[model samples]
Target: MSRTVVFIHGLWIHSVAWQPWQELFAGKGYETHAPGWPGDKDTVAETRLHSEGAGVGVDEITDSYAKFIAGLDSPPIVVGHSFGGLIAQKLLDAGLATAAVAISPAPIKGIKILPLSLLRSSFPVLSRPGNRNKVVPLTEKQFAYGFGNALPPAESAELYERIAIPSPGRPLFEASSANFTKNAPTAVDTTRAGRGPLLLLAADEDHTVPAAVVAAAYRLYASSRARTDIIKYDDRGHSAAFDHGWRQLADDSLAWLDRQSL
Candidate 1:
């Protein structure tokens, strides 16, 4: 059987957006799966219409994926975008993944640098405490600024119409206040020396999870002897994973996996 690859999507984006990635990885001789968060609808339109995932938090999302992976014949290589990136790392550390690729992953517990753009990108959920128990949808303008700032305005708008969906606010609140929270859900075991190789990708122009934030996450791995590497792309945003230029990121990921002999 072919080695498996599991793609995890982040907040505000539907799992279906990973179709192109799934096709590409499959062609490369990898079996692929992109599972949605717990309570997510089968389609983007349905998810948008009924925000059943309102109160889901990072712990719940991570656990759901863990359960999914537990049933697999073997541990798969995990790739994740935004919040999914964090989950990928967590899975890798837990020995549930053969390797991990975290693209523009949300900040883990030890990261303290919060860029103005990150705050703005999270405002849709973080501005009000009440939003913690509700699903919050981003306006087209907000999506444009947060996910597609590096793309043409028209392209950004079109992506918003196609793949965007309301996401739970609880994860944002949990990640944002992770440093102070005891047993924070956003925490990652960065110091695991025996964990699989990790590749962290960052878009220099990403408004949501800035490169600085990813750097901080990389720093948290300083104490670990595990192979942790990071790559940064110029003039790209958080949308790099699903945008027109997504192939570049995917190709690089394949190259990195080859280098690691994974």
Candidate 2:
């Protein structure tokens, strides 16, 4: 049978962020889906309005996604970025997905060393602890600086317009100060029998996730029974997935996935 694929978006981004990625995989014959997290609304306008008006926390969002996955009949090849990456790891640890790809995943338990880019990307949230309890939406300028710095102004603006949303402030807080342990909350149990393949794709110029930080996360999951691969995209920037010629990244992933027996 054909395998299923699931896309999990990072902080402040909804499942729609993966439409291009999903469509690419679909052309290659993988059924793909990206579920909306709890309190996450459709469109940039709705999410921005919601954040300014109400609040959604990390636990609430993750729990909502967990239920969504529990209902799926087929185990998917899950891919996630940033906070979504954290959730992807959790699902993999729980044996929910067949294989997983975590891109620029946030810092979790067992993921030590705070990359400066992570800190930079999160400056809007961690500028002060008080900000955590509040809903923080990125101002257009803020989005430009945090996520669009490496890309062209036009490309940055397009991305910002299409997907920028007010994300849970608490997730960033949690990542910042994880009470990390060997079997910590952020730790993924990759050794599960049913777990398939796992790839940790790091971008060398990715000031957002950084090569070293992703390297650490890869090492943590390398202990899995599932074969683990860490591939570095040198000269690729933080906006690697959305930048011009984004197909290169997608193409590379497809090549890697094809070689796997799973």
Per-model TM-score, in order, reads 0.98, 0.89
- Clash counts for all predictions: 0, 0
Model 1, 151-226: lDDT tens digits are 9999999999999999999999999999999989988888889988999999999999999999999999989999
TM-score of candidate 1 relative to the true fold: 0.98
lDDT of 2 by residue, 1-262 (tens): 3368878887766567788888999999988888776666666677777644234554565666667777788777788887777787777767777777777777657667776777887898889787776777777777776677777888888887888787767677766667543334455564555676777777777766778988887777666666888888877765677667568777877888888887
* Regions of model 1 farther than 4 Å from truth: none
| Model 2 C-alpha lDDT versus the unseen true structure | 0.73
Model 2: lDDT of residue 49:
73
